[model samples]
Target: MMKKYVCQYTIIRFLPYVETGEFANIGILMAAINQPYFGFEVIPSKHHGRITNFFDQLNKDTFRETVKVLRDELERVKDNIDFQTPNTSNYQDVAKMIFENIVANKETIVRYSDPRVLITNDPAKELDKLYKRYVERDFATKPHNDQVLEKGIREILQLNHLNKQFKQAKVGDKRFEVRFPFVKRMDGEPLKIIKPLHLRDKEPTKIREHGGTWWQKFVQLQDLNLLPEKVLVPYVGPLANDDSYDACESIIEKIRGLDIEVVQTSEESRILEFAAE
Candidate 1:
C-alpha cells in the first residue's frame, strides 16, 4: 500500500542572471510563516548581487526552518510514551514516516515571491528527493560551514589576547555537541539511515579513494542536531606516521581548555555495535 503524510512543498525560480552572456543561478526557500525567509542567489551578472543576496537570505531561512521541523518531529517520536515494541524493522518504519513528514512540512517553510509558487506531491519518495536536492544544492557548498568554522576559530584566537574576555567567553558551550547528519532513527521509531557513517567525516579522503567523482567526492555532514537522544562519535587511534596525534591532541586541548568533557575511544567493535543498533 502507498503511504501518505500530512505535509506538502512548493518551488519556484527566477530567470538566471546574465553577465557577459554568463548566467548565475540562485535558489531560495522560506520555512514556516513566522520564521524569517532566507535564500542563496547565484549572480550570473555582477550587477545582480542585490537579487542574489535577497535570495540568499531566503534560502538560509528555508534551510533553517527545515532543520527545525525535522528535529521537532524526531523528538516527538523519541518522546513517545506509548512506544512498546522496538526493533530494527520498526525503526525502519518510523524513519520512513519521519522522512515523509519532512516532505509534508516542506511547504510550511518554503517562501515564494508568489504564494502560488509551491510544489506538492505524495510525501513518500518526493520528500526524500527534495531533501537530497536541498543538501546537494545548499549545504554541500564548502565555504559555508568550513569558512564559518574558520572564522569562529580566528575569533577564538584573537579573543585570547585579552585573557579576561577570553576567560569570560565560552567556546561552543551551546554548540559543542557532536551532530549527526540527515535522517536518524529514534529508539522506538523507525527511520532508514539514509547516509552511512563514513559519509559523516569532516574529511573526504575515503570518499575520493572510493572512486567517487569530483562532485561525488564532496560529502556534507547530515544534521547531527537532528539525532534523538545522545550522540555517539566513534574515533580510532591516530595512525603511526600520520598527524592524527596532533589533530587529536588539538581537539583534546580545545575541549579541555573549554572545560568540555568528551570521551575518546579506539574500539571498532563497540562503534560498530552502536551504529548497527
Candidate 2:
C-alpha cells in the first residue's frame, strides 16, 4: 500500500497596492505534516512582465525586490532543516514550525493566505500543481481584477456587519437588467444598488468605454423606470494628477449628470452611510 501523508499549503499573494486590498497569487508554499518534505514555487522574472503590464502604474522593481527577499528567507529556513542537531528527532515538527513562522500573519505586500490541508504522497508534485493553478493562472478571463474591487467592498461591508443586508442581484425587467454586487431590496424588488466600478485602466479610452457602457444602461433603465430608487457607485481609477484623470472624471460627471450617486472607492464612510440608508 502506498503511504499517504497529510500536508498543508497556502498561496503567497502579492499585493501591489495594499490600500486597494487587491492581490495576485505569485507563489505557492507547500509543507508536509508527517514527512520531511517542504517545498515552494514562485513565479520567476521571465513571467513578471505580464504582471508588470497588468499593474502598469507600479514600479517593476517593487515586486522583484520583495519576491527576492521572501525567496531568500524561505531558502534559509530550508537549509536550517537539513542540518538539524542529532537531538532533533521529529523532522515533521521542524517543518511545521518553520511553515508556521513563514506564513504568520503579515500586513506587507507579500502575505500568506490561511493554511489549507490536503493529503498527498508527493508534496513536490502537489506544489507544482498548485503553483500552476494559482500563481500561473490565466489572467485574461477570470474577471479577476473586477472581482478584486468587488471583494474589497464586500469585506468592508462584512466588517461593519452590514453584508447580510445586501446580495448580488439583478434589479430590472427580464429584457433590461443590470446585475449589481451589493443590492438592497424591499418586498423582493430592489430599492438600492451598491456598485463598485473598476475604472483604473491603463488607458483613458478604456476607462471611458467602460463608464459609458454603464451610463447607457442607467439611461435605458431610467427610460423603462426600472432603475432602482437609489444607486451608489463607488469608483476606483487613476489619480487626479495623472493624465488619464480627466477622462475618468468625465465619465463620472456624466453619470452624476443623470443624478446617479458617485463616490471614490476609498471613501468608505460615504459608502457605509449610503448602504445603511
Candidate 3:
C-alpha cells in the first residue's frame, strides 16, 4: 500500500492542507488534538489517491480554494471546544505533541555519512577541504598528480592538506555532526572504522576487530526503517574535485535509478531534478 502511493505520485501535495497559515494556525493544532492518523486510512495510497481524484474531478483549483475557506471557518471556532487550554505552556509539551502527531502520520528514517578522515566532526568545512585539496593540485605534473601515497605519513599529510582547504573555505557549521549507515559487506560482516584506521589510504578490511560498536550501530540503522522520505547521504572526500564530482554523479545516478528526486547544492551551481516512475 505504501509502495503504491510512492509509485502513484509524489506525496507532498497533502502537506499544504495541514500547513499553518498566518491568521489561522489552527489546522496544525486540529491535526494535533484529533490525532488524524487514528481515523484516517493508515495506508495513504488507498485513501489519498481517491481524494486526489475526487478533488480533481470537482475542479482542483476551486476545491482547494474552498478548502482554504473551510479551514478559516473551522479555525474561527476551534477555541469553543470543551477542553479549552491555556495558550502558554511548556515548550517541551508542545514539541512532544507535534512530534508524536508527525511520527504517527509520517515515516521517520535515519541517514548516515562517512566523516572526513581528518576532521572527526563538522561537515561544511570538511566539504570545502575536499574541494580544495583535490582541485588545487598540480594536475600537469606526473609525480605530483594522481599519486596514491604508500606510507601512512603521506596519507595523513594529504588529509591534513584537505583539512586546511576545508578550514579556509569557512564552511564549517558548528551544529552538524557526522554519521553513516553501513550496509553489510559481501562476507556478511558489518562495516566498521576505527580512529587510526582512517590514516590508511585504502578501504579498511571489514572486520569486527576494527570496532564492534560501529558495526552494531551500522546493523541497527539498517534494521529500522527510521529514515523516511528525506534521505541524506554525506560525501566525505570533497565536492569540487574530480573524484568528488564522480562520486556525486554516481550517487545521483543510483538515486535517480530508484526514481527519487534530488537537489544538488554547491558554491557554483544549484540544480534540482526529480526521479519519477
TM-score of each: 0.21, 0.52, 0.20
Query: Quick one: best lDDT, which candidate?
Result: 2
Q: How many residue pairs clash in each candidate?
A: 38, 0, 11
Q: Write the per-residue lDDT of candidate 1 for residues 50-69, one digit (tens) a residue.
A: 43342322244443444454
List, residue by residue over 1-277, the lDDT tens digit for candidate 3.
2211000001112322221110101111112222111110111122233334322222345435534654453344333221343343443244335434333444211111121123123333443443333222112221121122113223342454422211111111222111322221214332221111111112121111112222232233333532223232222223454333444354445544433333422211211111100
| lDDT assessment of candidate 1 | 0.31
Q: Encode model 2's per-residue lDDT on 1-277: one tens digit a residue.
A: 8778789999988876554344667899887787777788888755677777555456778878888888898888777886772235588788888899889958678889889999987778888998877666534423465678899999999999999999997777755666678989889988888878878766685576567667776876788899886998898889888888988899999889888999988999999999887
Error of 1 at 47 (Å): 18
Global lDDT scores for all candidate models: 0.31, 0.79, 0.26
Error of 1 at 12 (Å): 33
For model 1, give the 10-residue run with minimal summed lDDT. 213-222
Ranking by lDDT: 2, 1, 3
